[model samples]
Target: QQQQQQQQQAAAGGDGGQMTEFSIALPAACAQYIVGTNMVNIPTLSKFGAALTLLRDNISGDVVFSYKGSPSAVAESRTLLMHGMNMFGVEIRRQQALLQEQLQA
Candidate 1:
């Protein structure tokens, strides 16, 4: 009976739960611009305006450049922090497994 109850509880719990929040921070300037203006323009560089001309030249559909730029330093920092959190989570999972093993033993 006790063994059956344990199995039932285990089945109910299943896998580890979902992550609540996910975020990536960007450059202060870019972030501010995104928040404030919400508009972007990409200029044609060549004398003939080849890029814009080509985009317009396309017969079927229009071409678009999705420009999202963030300062490298801030992006790097955020990546590092996320990596640290992932490492910490791995360590925690290992510790929990060890504890469970010891309890079962």
Candidate 2:
């Protein structure tokens, strides 16, 4: 039951990984809308152009996904998670910069 809960959390965070048998199977329409044809959605009432600008300035700036599990697990899965996020339309390099800042803080 505990494992299932953790799996749920991972999937909710867009982690479609097998290490924990987790994934959110987004519908085709939803997936396309999220990643758009060329970009990810900021998902606000603002216009798409404004949303793009906001994301450009800061993606997940006020938000962060912290690792709170086994260090060994993170060591093994961090690269995979990064790759998966990149594939799913996240601006990972930028986010990584933010993550580094957070870690330093």
Candidate 3:
């Protein structure tokens, strides 16, 4: 299991779970638009996808993630992936709030 995780980390451009150097191949469109003028359409995207879009602001066309040996590794997470993951949480809260408002109405 540890070996498998090492391989995954390597594939993700991290050296033994540290992302000091690696290649992140995003689509040409994403690369251009990550630093482009067009507004990202977030509503149509999945929460995870939307969060990744949010990372475009923090990352200078460079996305990063970190993993500790913890079972969940929540603390070791970097801003980009954490923000991307937070997108889902935000979406869920928004939906719940909307549902509550509708019920109140």
| Candidate achieving the largest lDDT | 3
User: Candidate 2: minimum summed lDDT over ten consecutive residues — where?
Assistant: 39-48
Model 1 TM-score relative to the real fold: 0.34
- Which digits, one per residue and each the tens of the lDDT, describe model 3 over residues 1-105? 999987997678666555232224443334333323222333212222533564655555434322333322333233433344455457568889999999999
- Which candidate should be chosen as best, given TM-score against the real structure? 1
**Candidate 1, 1-105: lDDT as tens digits:** 977765775567622221122244333332323222312131211211332344344323322222222243334434444454455567668989999999999
Give Cα-based local distance difference scores for all models: 0.39, 0.42, 0.45
TM-score-based ranking? 1, 3, 2
The residue pairs found clashing in candidate 2 are none
Give lDDT for model 2: 0.42
- CA RMSD of all predictions: 24.4, 15.6, 13.0
Question: Clashing residue pairs in candidate 3, if any?
Answer: none
Q: Give the lDDT ranking, best first.
A: 3, 2, 1
